[model samples]
Target: MSGNGERVVFVLDAPGDESLHTGGTIARLLDDGADVTVLFGSATSYDSDASAPTTASAGAADVAAARAALGETDPAQWRVLAGEPQGAQRRAVLGEAFAQAHATAVVAAAVDPALRQAAVDAAGEQGVPVFLSSRVSAVPGVRLTAIDVSDHIDKKLAALAAYPGRWRLDGRVVRLIDGTEALVTGTETYASGSGPAQPAELEAPTVGSRLLAVLMALFAGALFGVLGTVAHQTTIELGSLTIPVGLTLALLASGTLLLGLRLVVHDRLVVLAAAIGLVATVFLLSLRSTGGSVLVPAGVPGTVWSMAPALFAALVIAWPRIPARRPTA
Candidate 1:
């Protein structure tokens, strides 16, 4: 049943921001019991359902080099999904993979227009929700969802390393060490750390859970504040236009609130629900963009607003379903 979870599949042209759009989204999906399948043309993996984003390919020299790097066969960690010689045929292969994976949602990165169109077409036929990840857009769209996966950014960076020679993970990590290139989002206003942070080993860092949680929360909160500021500035230009809050800020605020409440409160689900409420509140409040703050709107009562979403979540948790409306003809 664990493996038989909702599948959130991404169809990519190759490895880049297009493929690595948000590691936190995938991480959150994994955490929330969702299966992720990344279908990329000329990628090196089988199934695309590996637990930890295991690496791929068919080139003799490339395979040998990869094997030499690992000092052994990768043991089918990578599987070839399809060969994109032409648009029509490629779409067919992707569609088949989606059916096989039982994909509940489909996301096509902004790489090839044809690829995205094929994805949209296939998803449309399946009557499933389809989305496109655009690096160009500064905000979310009616069809586009703004994903802020700052939480599992480390995992993302590590996964990029798994690709090898595709995007040169070294190139990515080298910039990350000084913080100017900041591979992940956080509260770090200035560079502080140095050395050995690049070309990530994907190895465990031994940071305690408590400390990690705190860091993640702070980063998310800082991200929220920054976005709020942007929203404020944008509003001044457009005459009170609401700036949509991205997903990362919500995650940061939610995680922070969750950890903070955990310090005193004991209910796991309840606390999580509460955190979601707070994050949701922060999300909406941030859209209003009242320069440099994550609090509820000035006139709105904080307690009621904060608890409302949690209370609704509690109700949902208890029932886990809502009755369908009956049409009276």
Candidate 2:
């Protein structure tokens, strides 16, 4: 979907609670041109059959009305399944649905424990990742990712309006009731393992944040450069050969630091900032002082130290960006 071509399936509980919890994220996905399919589960009881009917119940109409309000005009994008099956039956039904949709990732609400577990199990069997809608909790081995849906807050609110019985809109705020403390928010958080359902391209950082990153990178690079320069001269006598272990370690540390920034920040400008600080520090230290003393003497170790950091910086800055791969069925 979009340029990434990912088909995301959302298995949700009731038309109101689960929808409110993930409406903003749903709207964002649809806006991104991703192929989004929503499967709304039956709230009343679990249907035992593997092949449940797709009949339009009263709840199904509410789901349709909500989808329409959320800008999901395409009728085929959603389906109201007849039952919420349990045990192996539930897994089988959900598994078949996921396979049919060829879902790259599944977003399941935690409102219904059975449905949530079934979705997770089905997705795991297919090797597809699952995202659970809820606040970040300490789940061992799971990574938490928060999506900023502030841009689609209005659409989410509109969708919530469909369930007037549950949510009440008071002026600009949407609350659970007229005097309740619970309210809807613009940000939606989810927990996943390995690949979270983040946007294909993250939103660009604000100018202020970018500037802060650059400044921090520059300072960190300068600090590392100073430490490396100080320790680059130490040598270890191993039998007949003199091993410049300090020089090797220093170079390795600088390279590792720069590589980490490139991989984590995913920003060339920030990397360039750090590189400039490191290379500039080494250059300054290499120059002979007015009193005729030099920190980095003219030698093999000095020459390598002078040039290695700049080369490492160039490689990191020039490295091509690779798109993340989602697990396949």
Candidate 3:
């Protein structure tokens, strides 16, 4: 297999008249079954009688030469475009050319920094791969490695082609190696967006919170215990009738029900149940001590004190799983 999809190699003339380098690259790409486009400067004498030099005349001549070179070529296989002096204009021209050419890869001379930067930027915008020629001499039978510092698509493709079996493409980075495992890395020049955030793990309860919760539960339990003991000890009378054992049982049962609700239910419901139970327990206990009179009111405050521990535990358990706010699609 020839790897993934169809590949197109772009060759542009360098600043120092490096058309030979560009031509060699084009030939190699053609041999590898890649469609090739050679964008040469108008100053070259391939067609000597073309045109003379006025700013307007030069631009027209360059455009004509590019058109002539690309004419009669298969739309699927090859194309050519000329570069302008202005960076923005060049970028716009190259962008349109790459789109029209359906170029999959770019191989341009690395000698011109401005042109190289422009080409790289255009390739990125088009989502095409790029390869930069290095100054180092190529050793016989040794593969050339392209490093992807920025993880751009063009650089990765070049690295894949140049190193083949000895290359690894990771995200935006490509790792290239020789037969002996010796490496030369090239930096990619592209950017990808950030990934999603990960969820956090739940942590153990803190010493202080645990201690406070326990103390609150104990305090509530102790109040009920005291009331039970008191109701057992005291006697009460109402309208010529004696109520001793019944009042004691009522207070004990109320306390038990509240305690059970607090343990079984969630925190939100715990407080209400705890309050009612505590009030009943306190009133019954007070009746035993005060001869069945309503002088000492039910201990409503005691319910709050007793429910504190349960509330704390509920808070701790629910905090870690709190729902996060999701972004709008």
Candidate 4:
């Protein structure tokens, strides 16, 4: 749902996995004008017989041919990541790939467990929606999205044809040569952690949009500062004890605003903008007004109210980003 267009990244274990699982979806996405990027892990051995084992370069060529058969002509779109898909470096590389592509959605079609997990984690951390292929084992509570690839089945078959001995196509039906498996369906299934419940529009934020967000954040912060300043003096007096309810609520609100922005928005600059606005507003309000009246009078409640929000904002802003949880089995 990105304004620039729908850019999809397919994470695959090998060249043939794309044709086996997501061939139809890939063809359909290409026909719809969505930019498709295929990232294959270390090449897979396609030959079941040891005498005719497929080399890495050969497997890569076959996948490139498959993509070509599906009408993906741009060689740049097909990439093979070096090294095993494990460790933080691999995850970081995948994250950078998604970020660079401005991917709207990710398809985790890799059969490798580590690769699958890495893809899911990378996409989730970036807040990009990732769909797992049926090749991936099902985890309960997760939602599924089935794509009707009836119209693109022919293109899928054409792509599969690239894998000579691995897949055999007869007319409209295709069978995997590995023995008792057949693929003649018009539907391709993909599962997501939340399914389609939480839709994400993954366009990279532009300079203009970021500036506007910062300005709005500043306005929001200033607004809260003014509100907190005006309300910090209220108290509930019961017997000899006076409960500073207003001051407590003001500090709570400040913490919530800053923390929520940091976690939900995941944009430090915006949170910093809001913090600046809030603190500045508080400081300005603490000074005497034109009418010689102080909104934040000097006292324990006033001091705490004036200082707590900035401290809360600082702590929230300084908090290190925690990686998102990986999809469960």
Candidate 5:
């Protein structure tokens, strides 16, 4: 946020006073000529003993070292702050800093919805953009950016080397990061910089949120199972094969599950969970409904009827948010 129109980026809400998770992203941002400000705490990490340099100190020192190593040394281009708290306090400090630096984008990692909401509000106040970073696949419908960082691995590792005591970039760590893709998410309101996004709209994808979605899935599953049970008995057998009728009912059951989930769920991932629950429930119910009895003549048709509901449920639930497919050579 300089008068010279340089893009200012804020990296915040990182855990345990460590940039090992986000160091590379920060380096890539700096290399892209953006003024990056890294804010982290000093006393937050238990691993940081009395002898170690905190991430705050390491951040300042590392940025300086990296700049010097890269043959650039302008102090105004970056700054690192220690002891920035989250939630309302974070909002105040973040707002003031963003205003002072005229920040353009804020990258927050592992922050709760409340803190993120506060930060996004601050961003909206100034009409600036915000990005939420996540490493989980539990829920990912709102993701906004998903850039691959393999190209900037060298610079990222070089930046990590700034904290010598604990964070020497290892080959295993690099491969882990390279293998696991990062997911950045934000609500639709995030697109409207000047408008505040709803809190529920930005589900924080915490363990609690994930469990809640699982529960919803279970409920949806039960509902779909009950309906499919009644419909399965009505399927007309076709000679030796009952695949056609069973498949049709399965497709219908899948559609029913999808529609029911949409009526009650907000998150796409939640809908997926419910659909999965529906499949499991259908299979279990089918097993029970059959009661170890074979069909009058078409036993194969009975098996087809038993399996169709679950199969269709899976297909519908997984269709909307399929993960990005990897490119093959």
Candidate 6:
């Protein structure tokens, strides 16, 4: 038992004598004024003579006998729980019985291979201590230790240090300690490999840089808006129809792209890219405009002129500078 008021003890019993051991252990525990209960694997057979002492040959009658032997004047004090022959049912029964009885320790012989494994697994799951024995002893002082292959102590300590909170893997179960189903599935490898490099010093934008970028974008937008309005008012006629307004929209789009690049890369690359785009826009609008006229209203030529100022400003702000190294004496 841990320092948490839980009990820990060992019971002695033969491999096939779970019934006898269960009854005797319970009787001995009650006599010693210990608040503990005994868990016995269900018997496969039934007999009147065998029922008298709660042996493997005893059926439900043995449970009654065992309860009576425990001096359980109240029906709730001694409860007999029958476990399935194998699988999760058996594990649950043993765990449930141990919890209900408030048994700080358990004493039972290693009987069935399946049961033995189930007991160990369930105890591990519940953080309960189990004691295995091979001989049925009427004595309660028989020393026993649970052989646990799953070294849970170390695993539990490591988990607590890594993630200090209640973690659930299956969405239903809480992984309190090590070897629990939740811990096995949820815990991940920490030292798998290295990660991507941290961004460079230039990439780390200061408050001033961010504010300046925002102001630049706003100023560029306002300048382009004025240019667009001016181009719209002065409709330049080409052949029979007026020039398309899409030219100004294109310039605005190019300026927005440049500002985005500046925000991301934070260097002269943005300015160079934006200047190239702006020059290309102007050339394309010039070629497409009526008679290659720059005065065409609502046309590409007028739009390029309107966007020129903002595009130049973006270039200037996005330009990169070389850092000065300190002089060593």
Best by TM-score: 2
Weakest 10 consecutive residues, lDDT, candidate 2? 45-54
Model 5, CA-based lDDT: 0.51
Question: Model 3 over residues 144-175: C-alpha lDDT tens digits?
Answer: 34322222233223423332233354543444
Candidate 5, 1-329: lDDT as tens digits: 12134554544433222244554455445566656665542233222123323343344465566544332356654443436465567677667777877676765442334444666677777777666554311233453434444555665555445555443345425322214322221111112123275421344568897788778676866776666555555556678854446446755766776766654454567766766666666556655334675222246545665666556556555556444332211
Candidate 4 lDDT over residue span 36-85, tens digit each: 99998756643424423355333666777898987799988987786744
In the range 1-329, model 2's lDDT, one tens digit per residue, is 24157788888755565456788778877787777888766643222232342232236666678888777888887765657666878778888998999999988764556666777787888888888775312344333466767788888777777776655776546565434434667577777742324322244689999999999999989988998998898899989999998899999999998999998888899999999999999999989999999999989999999999999999989989764443221
- TM-score of each model, in listed order: 0.40, 0.56, 0.31, 0.53, 0.45, 0.31
Q: Of the candidates numbered 1 and 4, which has the greater lDDT value?
A: 4
Clash count of each predicted structure: 5, 2, 10, 0, 4, 7
lDDT of 6 by residue, 1-329 (tens): 12234343322222113222233333334444556543445443222223322332333444354345444344454333453344878767777766665655555443354555565556656665555443321223222322221223233333223222222333323353233332222111110101112110113556788567555644554444444443533445888997545555645555565665565555554445445544543444434345655433464565556556455655656566433332111
Judging by lDDT against the true structure, name the best candidate. 4
Give lDDT per model, in order: 0.45, 0.74, 0.41, 0.78, 0.51, 0.42
What range of 10 consecutive residues in model 3 has the weakest lDDT sum?
192-201
- Candidate 1 residue lDDT tens string, 1-329: 13245776666654333224544455555555666665665543322223222243334454334322322243232234545544778667777877887888876653455565676666666665665554311222122333444554565556545544444454344242113242444111111111122211122334475455545544544454344333322222246674333333433443455555454433344444454534454456545444665544443333333443355444433543232232111
List pairs with backbone clashes in candidate 4: none
Q: Estimate the overall C-alpha local distance difference test score of candidate 6.
A: 0.42
TM-score computed on alpha carbons, candidate 2: 0.56
Candidate 3: where are CA atoms >4 Å away? 1-5, 14-19, 41-85, 136-329
Model 1, position 115, has a per-residue lDDT of 61
Candidate 6 — worst ten consecutive residues by lDDT sum?
187-196
